[model samples]
Target: MSTETPTPFAARPGFVADEATGVAAHYGNPLSEQRDLAAGRALVEAGHRAVITVTGPDRLSWLDSLTSQSLKGLAPGQSSETLLLDPSGRVEHAAAVLDDGVTTWLIVEATEAEAFAQWLDRMRFLLRVEVAERPDVAVVGAFAGLQGVEALAPNGLPLVWEDGWGEVAEGGVAYADEPSHPARDWTYRETLVSRDALAELASSPVPAAGLLALEALRIAAWRPRLALEVDERSIPHELDWLRSAVHLDKGCYRGQETVAKVHNLGHPPRRLVMLHLDGSDNVLPAHGDTVSIAGTVAEAGDEGAGAPAREVGQVTSAAVHYELGPIALAVVKRSTPVDAGLVVDAQDTAVAAAQETIVPPSAGAAAGVPRMPRLGAVRR
Candidate 1:
């Protein structure tokens, strides 16, 4: 659990609790709040996220050798993201990274902070680095260039982390082929502030958007969250995360080999897609809900039915967007046809799902080496 201080915004009028995230779900009108947030007229209390600080001269270099992104040369006030992967290249943890010359700040999900900090500390053998979790530090999120937020930073630097999600970072690669990806218009930022600053803002006139509003925007932008998008078998290629988080040409890190092999020789087993859910029933599919090709389930229920509907994928995140009635991000088998009409099983109702490709089925095999004929097989 998070060791962070409780958010003061919860006491505000119209606040509804989102226990899973430990933040206010909404301040009554989630749609209005989302509009305000996207227009840069509101700020969000992000106490559900935690801050971990790594200080000392060796911080950058030491971090560089452990994560997927190249970090040794990060400039002060620079923003980037890196993933800590298991030996076989499965995502274990993710953090939004920022450097302030004297310290490197890692903003991660609150639930993962303690373990993440402990793991980092254990890895610091003889390195001149000291890792510490800052429970007193809180996070505030808003659209980039929103005024007044930066002033709340305890230090002059603000320790702000501008998200690099939509654009491909240096040495990175992109799998999404849209002329303009939804994420390209996302200009989100997170600023670290002291607990006193959070209370000050809660009492201020600055408008507040809740987690519900933020989540709607995130879903519309097709941004993947670690807690939602990642699973035991997840890889960067599956979610098109290489666009921002993975530096394809970076020096060796823990999972570098698997990353290289998958990009060069094999395709990811699954791919991410956006689902425009049927909102006629006004029902939203929850995370882990079944997703399958339309008609499969209904057909299976007939008197002398065929095989039951096989789950092609599962919904990772879902939300009701102001402009887009209902939308979700799901990870499905890569071989599931891109043009196939899909459905989501929500509350025993078959909700039609229109598929929008985020990561294409042909998302890997970057090296593109020619295939050789199989033994005793005739060549076409």
Candidate 2:
């Protein structure tokens, strides 16, 4: 493919919102656009929101022993999600770890590092491990048909790509693998590129997509993200996050007991579902909106005008898709009658909603193996 610079949004028939932010006006019905792989110019390195580096001879083994996922299998140039849990198994922080063979880099939410670092430090008495925060090494995101990779680490902050689908780097060098996967990161040496180079790279230009578009792609692909699908009360099973993150056979770690019990014997209380909204209405329900069965509205609006239009579930994240119209991902009580009609109140408008299960009923179902459950209520 030709590597010529892609057309900027300004040259296109879109309105510019402001000069400082450079946000483009998305007037065309978002639902009418095509859903396909984005192409064109590459993205710039805008520095990561948070960065944590783990060093020391016992780094790999130490981390493997503590995290919920199996870290032993990770090799250089690989990245995976791992969760840190309290003694009782509640998640403390979920992180994306990039292991480049020598050093392991963790990118996590901004608010999570202090607690995570303190926890790691508390566990690091005899082990030969070192944990440090490197705010100097900035993280950047790039898309488009970019080729080649290079790193500049004059200050010992090496930049490398964790490699999934797309090429990403800090200082011109690719870090990870091709076709970047969700939650991937690239590390680079801090000094390889100068301030001007960084600014120029940041201005390289790519489609300015908001979190909504990103969430839609993530939900459709069944990828788990924090705060949206994962909550303090949520178990990993509910989100189907185990596909790549959880290791059932791994040795005991914090919360492993609860994880095992829920996975093998008990059912998660709720399951994640994709909500296809009634596109004709153009109504998008806010998060935490009640979903109710059809025609169940109380007289005089006693239950709050939009009280979960049948209590099948609540929306976790929603966005008006340029192609899919108004789409939402929600968690519903798994025991809710699957065939029951569901609706959500979008302010004054009650929008018809349909729930499609994204996660199977049980882990046995997940493996394509058969397992029986106690029979419950049956509808005539």
Best by TM-score: 1
What TM-score, over all chains together, does every model reach? 0.95, 0.70
In terms of lDDT, model 2 sits at: 0.56
Give the per-residue lDDT digits (tens) of candidate 2, residues 306-376. Answer: 44334666778777655556778787786766665677777877788776666545432223436655589
Clashes of 2: 40
lDDT score for residue 317 of model 2: 78
- Model 1 ranges off by over 4 Å: 1-6, 151-155, 299-306, 374-380
Off by over 4 Å in 2: 1-49, 142-198, 205-208, 298-310, 363-380
RMSD of 2: 9.1
Model 1 lowest lDDT segment of ten? 149-158
Question: Over the stretch 146-177, how does candidate 1's per-residue lDDT look in tens digits?
Answer: 77774434435768899988788998898887
Model 1 clash pairs? none
